[model samples]
Target chain A: MKVVYLDNNATTQVAPEVLEAILPYFHDFYGNPSSMHAFGGQIGAHIRTAREQVASLLGAHPDEIIFTSCGTESDNAAIRSALYADPEKRHIVTSRVEHPAVRALCAQLSGQGYRITELAVDKDGRLDMEQYEQSLTPDTVLASLMWANNETGVIFPVEKAAAIAREKGILFHTDAVQAAGKIPIDMGKNTIDMLSISGHKLHAPKGIAALYVRKGTKFSPVMVGGHQERGRRGGTENTPSIIGLGKACELARQNLSQENTQVKKLRDRLETALLNAIPKSRINGDTEHRLPNTTNISFEFVEGEGILLMLDLYGICASSGSACTSGSLQPSHVLRAMGVPFTMAHGSIRFSLSIYNTDEDVDMVIEKLPPIIERLRSMSPYWTGDK
Target chain B: MWEYTDKVREHFLNPRNVGEVENPDGVAEVGSIACGDALKLTFALDENQRIKDIKFKTFGCASAIASSSALTEMVKGMTLEEAQKVTNQDIAAYLGGLPQEKMHCSVMGKEALEKAIENCLGVTETSADETAGHIICECFGVTDQDIERAIQENRLSTVEEITNYTKAGGGCGSCREAIRGIIDKIQFEMTPQTAAKAKLSNIQKIKMIEETLEREIRPSLKLDGGDIELIDVDGNRVMVATRGTCATCKAADITLKHFVEKRLRDLVSPDLVVEEVTQ
Candidate 1:
């Protein structure tokens, strides 16, 4: 079967270059980075290079990059460290559309006595800047928001949001897991105190991620152990995965333009073709501001999970914000937050492409998806097609 | 991805009956676009009042569409009486089995079939109005009676299970407490008079105790930099120990008697007594 994978925002296939760069660490540099021996010490230099490589991608200081297990760990560490550092500031604010890494943690924090303000988004999945500004209270410790929505791929004004928090003397963090590789992010010019990136999203192996903490940001550690990550994150370093992540980041920096151009064109073609082919279908999220690789489309009356199953049979991989796909009865919280009608919300499908995807993949999807939607719609009780 | 059965996949890929019966003797629709899945069922009756043909138009997940497809095949040649005997379980069983969370899809198929039979008989057994029953779940528009029937039939014990069977507390979770209350009421009704005295399992008792303390007692205690922990639940007596400021508060005994005891009685069994276990 020819697999047509379009669920890149979930996780991605590890780039061959990244895998080649990482595999040798398992055999040659198996010595712990924290060991006193020269074998380990030599490994540390490579790690330093890896740090610099990741730093170069974000335009961050090498000293500021803290490698964690994944984006969830990075997000947890960022929010907890900020709150722990500023115990007096009991209020925390974030956008409602944040990935569960931030949203669930913040929700738990609210139960633990810290105030949480989840800022709402508009119909286009764009955050309200005015409300964001008002949300920064005197005791606001930090404001964490995502750079892009995983489901909708709607980009946020995170740089401006970070600046607003910076003006209020509040620590700002952005979970840039979905944003970092797709969009150009230069920390040197931005006011974001902390930014998170998951390695797998950018073609590195899973279970490796980095948090970019601005130089001299008041730091507190989520996990304290042996002197690693400059005592920011602990436990012996994930040597191979970290190296892989750094390689992925370097590749991401190099492919930034290609990602925006070739990948964007493929994504646009997929969306435009899908919309044209399917009736009563409309795109979710803001068309002008989405990530270059993603397009969320809703085929009304025909549920998403049904369409996904049909697509799966054809070896096409994608994801859905529909109720069934969410492992819960409700539709995607991001779509629900945007006030998307239930009719469309249950049928919303997210097609996120990657640099590896070609025109054939997009065209194949365009040809395959319409028949599936039509078949499901023909069976749909509410679908009269006359409307 | 859902672990769909091979039978479900087969039915979904090549549904047995995919079109409506022409000039059908009966027709019915259940669910709506807002509800995420729906089914429109139609059937024609022969001279002997036997179902000559049956077909369905369904909008939902694979299981939902497959269940509808399976239901049509199951009822095609059966009499209306035999068709009326079809349950949600029958539909799911015809397609091997559906995921427990997707049981509602089969349930929808059964309901649509029942409504189709009712349409033929000009009966008023099933009502789809919001006024017919008080809406407990505003998100799915599930009513109190709908929830009660689902509980009784499915033997659902948890709000999560109730949601899986009927999508009651599956939305914003605002109706979670209401759903829990209904589950509790249904369980109590089924409990024998003698069983009511010891209705809760050890797991259930511990869960109920922990939930009561966390929901009712923990917040006020935590606000005072204090906390309560359930040491053990031994029959009707709940052994608890306090931590933080709660351990040494001057009003500790009064707080235990007045606050903890009252809440435990209201939510859990009335006979539950909170006894503080000293460190």
Candidate 2:
């Protein structure tokens, strides 16, 4: 089967250059970055270079980047550090559309007596800045929001939101897992105190991620062990994966413009072709303010899982926000927060592209998806063709 | 991805009898768009009153479509009685067993079959709102009767199991306590206790009544600024005193009989009655 993978926001295919760069570290240079031996100490230099590479992509200082297990750990470390720094502040402000890493942690915090203010989004999955500003209080310890929603690809004004939080002397964090590689991020020009990036979301291997903590931010270590990651994160370095992430980040910087131009064109082409080919279909998020390489479309009167399965038969990979896909009776929380009708919410499919995606990939999905939607719609009791 | 059986995938990919029968004798729809799945079933009967041609149109996941497809194939050429005997389990068994979460798909199939049969038999041409059984899970529009039927038919023992089978408590979960009440009621009824069974000792009866009050009745009562304290348990008359707002509330007696007594009967024993001891 000629697999046409479009589920890049979920995870991306590791670039060949990244794979090749990391293989030598796994075999020849397989030494603990923390070891006393020269062979191992040499790996430390490479780790520093990797940190610089990641920092360069985000426009941040190398010393501020701390590698962790994955995006979830980075999000956890950032949120926990904010709370730990300001223990007196019992309230936290976050969006309702956050990924579970931040949302679940906020939920757990709410149970432990900390207040959580989950700001709502508009019908376009765009946050109401006035509501966000009103949500912050003197008691608010931090404000955590996502740079881009994983499901809908809607981008939030995290930089502007962070500035608002900063004015209130509140720490701000952004789960940039979905935003980092696909979009250009300049931490130096922003007020975001902490940002999270996952390796696998780009073209790096899994099990590696980075948390960017501003140089002067009051920080607390979530994982305390030996002086690894300058005691911010404590674990023997995932040397090979880190090296892979470095190469991935370097490549991401080079391909950033191509992502916005070529990948975005493919995504738009696919979205436009599908909407033209299929009736009763619409985009889920703000098309103008979304990730460059992502498009979430809803085919009414048909369930998403069925569309995805039929797509799978043609070796086309994608994802959905449907309840059946998530194993929950309710549809996607992001869509629900945006007040998307259940009729369309159950059938929303997210097609996230990447640098690797070509015109053929987009065309293949365009060619294959409309028929699948028509087939499923034919089976739907609600589908009356005209309506 | 769901570990859907190959049979389920097969049926879903190439669903049999996909469409409605023309001028069908029996036609019905189960589930709704809001609930993320719905099925419309139509069947024509042969002169001998057996199902000659049956077809389904479903709007749901792969498993749901497959279950509907599998159902039309299973019931074709069968008498209405035999088709009525087709359980959701049988549908799932035919598909080599669905994932536990997708069991509701098969249940939807069974409900569609039963309703279509009722339509054929002229029981109700309008297809009595499938959701007409006292809506328990408002999000999913699942009913208490729906939960009870799922529990009884699937031998479900937990609230999660009921959700899997009927999507009763799979939403906001505010109805979980109500679902637990239904589960307790059905399990107690199915316990095989008869009139000839061993009688409960006084101590055992008192302990059971107290347990029911604490476990079931009190929490719900407290939610409404009320509380119940077990005063005594003599024979089947369990005495309880309402504290807080419940003591002076206008609906105290109604609470005593409907809420308190019903819970006691459902959880401890069916014969038990609740009486409030006025201060």
Candidate 3:
């Protein structure tokens, strides 16, 4: 059976054009971009062109795009730089539902004496603006927000948040790893001082990402020793992968308008069929603001892992709410943060679509999934007669 | 997913005698969602005190659900007394063996059975009396005097070695210091430093090791119906092979780690590692 790949939120398959552009760099055109020799100077020109392509996607200046290893590294650099820029200020503000990369980093910083205020979100995974406003003080140095949540696919008001942070004179950073390619982002139009983006979330390979730092922003390098990215990010460039990311960004920008509409329709059809065929199954986040290509739902009484296993047997790729933390058995922290009850939390699953998905793929999923849920629910002890 | 044994998967997927008996002679319930699992056990008792039918309803992980199912299957033809002796280890052993972390699920089954038995007796099950005159282990506040007498009477080797005989020091490990205190006091009184000068012969040392194992370790394992055999004697370092209920028990490592080693080290020599001889 052909596998239906629906875990785009976790990562996306590299686009064909992006892969073709990157292959030449690995063998025939291989050269050190920093090398002064003619053989290497040609590769350095490709790097500049790639940077401009990525910059165009985000409406950022080519100089603002500083390549990093991955989204987490970019988030780390941005948050750490904000702290370094204003050492006297000791407060940071962020949301409770941030991905572990940001959440864990903030948690570690909190232990090191930074007073972090984790703003709470409402049931739809939207943050409270009132709490965001109250969290700011003279000591607040940064407001780190995410453009979109990886788990629920709920979009945050990043532009409004940047405006708020600007009024407070606090630097704003966004982990836009999930939003960069899926949605329209114009950093030039927003008040965002810094933003983080990853390659894997788009149609680019892993291990390459970038941090966009607006010009004239007070910046400090978290990683020292090398002069790469103009001493802003210090690491030997991952030439092939970075080149792939740039090409992927260009393709995503080219096809985004049409692919977004097509993928959204596929997602909608899948959601509609599953909800109609199964009782008590509904979307988990605000439908209107959620990513057009992602859908998270809960099937009451049936556990997510059990359904996932059955789906796995049929060659379907998906994600569940269970997080294997070092030796503790608990449901997802994200679902729990949203105040989802334990009974329903274990039943939540995420299906993130990509441009590679098709109407037939949606139809196959719609045809195959309800029976799997029905089979698992039949064996569940908590199943009510309504099901 | 848990790497469940074939037997465990079979029991969980097609669990035996699930759901409650309409009119049960006795009912036993233990654990709750707070503890991550809960079981409701019901039994149909025969005139001869045999279990005519056994049924259970469990809301837990796969191992927990499987343990309950396997327990219900094992106890149907057993007398109430025989069923009472069917320990958590027997439940785990019946299902090929559970992972160490899921050992608590099998234990929950035993607790539910015992609770059902106590319920059948119509006397409120005695809470393991928290505020009492009996002093166990000072480390975990297990009443020393009660647990000490139980240890002497029951022949317990180590502290977790005693959880089978007495549910102390199993929570938070605060009572271990108190247990060590008592063990030190007893050793000091029994083997006074002068006894070391008396020169324990190699035969006597070996006999002392045998006595400690037979008296202390075996009985504790028997509570779970597990047994251990002496593999070889090498001065203070002893090798033992766990068997029966313990051979495949998940906490068999915990048994060897905290209990077996501590006992042999205290009774035989301080240099004992208590290595397990596989097969």
Candidate 4:
């Protein structure tokens, strides 16, 4: 059927090289890195090397990276731990467009006597720096923000936010799950005290993520148990996935430049064709400042789920802004926060590219999508006028 | 991947009768893509009052697309009267079975067929005037009397309960207030002065839920005509039985979690939990 996958923001297929790197740990190299046996000691060396590989990608020291279960876990740990690290400060500043992993958790914290200031974003999904600056207070303990939005792919000014927070002596954490592999990130120079990365967002398997706590930064362990990652995290090490993530990070560092140029061009080509071919279609975020491999577009008078189903029929995978959460009738909160009209919000579709996607795949979507949208619009009562 | 039945898979994979018919005798459409689906039905009527051909174009999920395909194939050689009688249930039965939430897909087909018939007859596709006036379930534009009768016919128990029989008030829910008004009107009409003297009874509430389900919610699911079973009764907690199509629907969770649970809780009991029975 010649399936074409474009839903990279949701999750990515494991890369062959990353798979090869992880296979050895599953078979002959299986051993607890914490044990005193020779086999365990040998595997411990491999774990150290993997740690270095991941650290190199983020431009952090080897001891700074602590592996977690996933991006959500890391986000929870970072935000909650920041408050614990500085108990006197009962205020937190963040943006409204953060993933539910952060937003929902923050909302939960709001019930526990913590004052949260949610900064607003512009219509194009860009955070308002002026509003962010004004929201900061002496009581603000942490400024947790995302490097890039999952739904819109709009890049946030992490460096600026970190600098502002550092000037105020407030700790900063950036959920870089979507930005880690797709963009150039040098955490060491950004004043970013803490950062989070998810393996599934790249090509490593799900249930593997890492938290980057810069050396000398105050951090409290969210999980309490064993002395893994120097007690920063607890539980038996997910050796295979950790190793996979390390390999994925190394690959990311190697291919990031090529991806920025080549993958970005492919994504742009797909966006251009879609916007040119489909009537009443417009891009959802700032095209110039988004992730190289991501694009979101709204097809007016057409619902996202229907468009997604049509694309599914053609063996083209993507995501939508329609009711992103499990049960809510409303569309994506990111779009809603951007003040996007309800009609347009429901019609938005996200197409995220990866190194694996090709021109032929984009061409297939370009060929198949217009007729589907036109056909759907023809039946729409709301789209009575010329499209 | 979902375990789609061979019939469902076939309809989804190689959908029958897709795309719009060019300048047809009559075109009937429902469920726009924005509403998660849209259908365009074109039919040719013969001199003998039978349908010569029926073609459809649908933009929706697998169930909706498949239901429309199955429906166009099912009604090709039937008379307008016979086609009008072809319910979403009949469509689901023909396709072996559909999931419960997808049942709305089949109901969409029935609605399209009815609308097509109305279009063919040179009449403005008005609401049925049998025992009902145009007391549309403003949320989804379903009539009042139709809801009243559906409640008596289907034994519906709650507002979410009605979606299984009729697809009323299933839209944006702006129509629910109107539905409530209609319910009170029907009750008052049933017992003139007693309406003012007596409080609305539990039986009356349950009856209203049944009517809403049959007239409004059910028809929507019937588009795919997946069977929804009434599981059990525990005080206000009504356990539903979803089989055939609904038994394995992906959004069956969504149907049970949001649509079914919310509607029932809002209209009948706020503490109700419309749980899906594990197979």
Highest-DockQ candidate = 2
- Candidate No. with top lDDT: 2
Encode model 4's per-residue lDDT on A1-387: one tens digit a residue. Answer: 878999999999999999998998888889998889998778888878889989999999989999999999999999988999999999999989999888999899999999998888889988888888888899999999999999889999999999999999999999999999889889767899999999999899999999999888988999988999999899989999999999999999999997789999999899999998887888888877899999999888766766777788889999888742222334677887888776677778999999999889999999999988876665444565453
Residues A153-245 of candidate 3 have per-residue lDDT tens digits of 999998999999999899999999999888999988999999999999999999999999999898899888688888887777889998999
lDDT of 1 at A142: 94
Q: Is candidate 1 or candidate 3 better by lDDT?
A: 1
- Model 2 lDDT per residue over B4-41, tens place: 98999999999999999999999889899889999999
The per-prediction tally of clashing pairs is 0, 0, 14, 49
> Which of candidates 2 and 4 reaches a greater DockQ?
2
Model 2, docking class: medium
The TM-score ranking, best first, is: 2, 1, 3, 4
Please, what are the lDDT tens digits per residue for candidate 2 over residues A1-387? Answer: 899999998899999999999999978999887788998989999999999999999999999999999999999999999999988889999989999999999999999999999998999999999999999999999999999999988999999999999999999999999999888999989999999999999999999999999999988999999899998988889999999999999999999999889998988889889888888999999988999988989988889999899999899999998999999888999999999998999999999999888888888888888888888888999988945
Q: Is the docking of candidate 4 incorrect, acceptable, medium or high quality?
A: incorrect
Lowest summed lDDT across 10 adjacent residues in model 3 chain A is found at: A322-331
DockQ of all candidate complexes: 0.60, 0.66, 0.13, 0.13
Per-residue lDDT of model 4, residues B1-279, tens digit only:
334477976886567776566666777876543344567788887778777777876655566667888888888888888887887778888888875445556777777887788788776644434434775755344566557765544333345534434456555566666666655555445443433323445565456456545544565466566656555555566677676677778878787767666655555555556766665
For model 3, residues B118-173, the per-residue Cα lDDT tens digits are 77767564553333347553323446664564455434446555553344555445
Off by over 4 Å in 2: B125-132, B194-279
Chain B TM, per prediction: 0.68, 0.69, 0.57, 0.56
Candidate 3 — which residues are off by over 4 angstroms?
A323-327, B1-16, B26-38, B43-76, B85-104, B107-110, B113-268, B271-279
Output the better candidate (1/2) by lDDT: 2
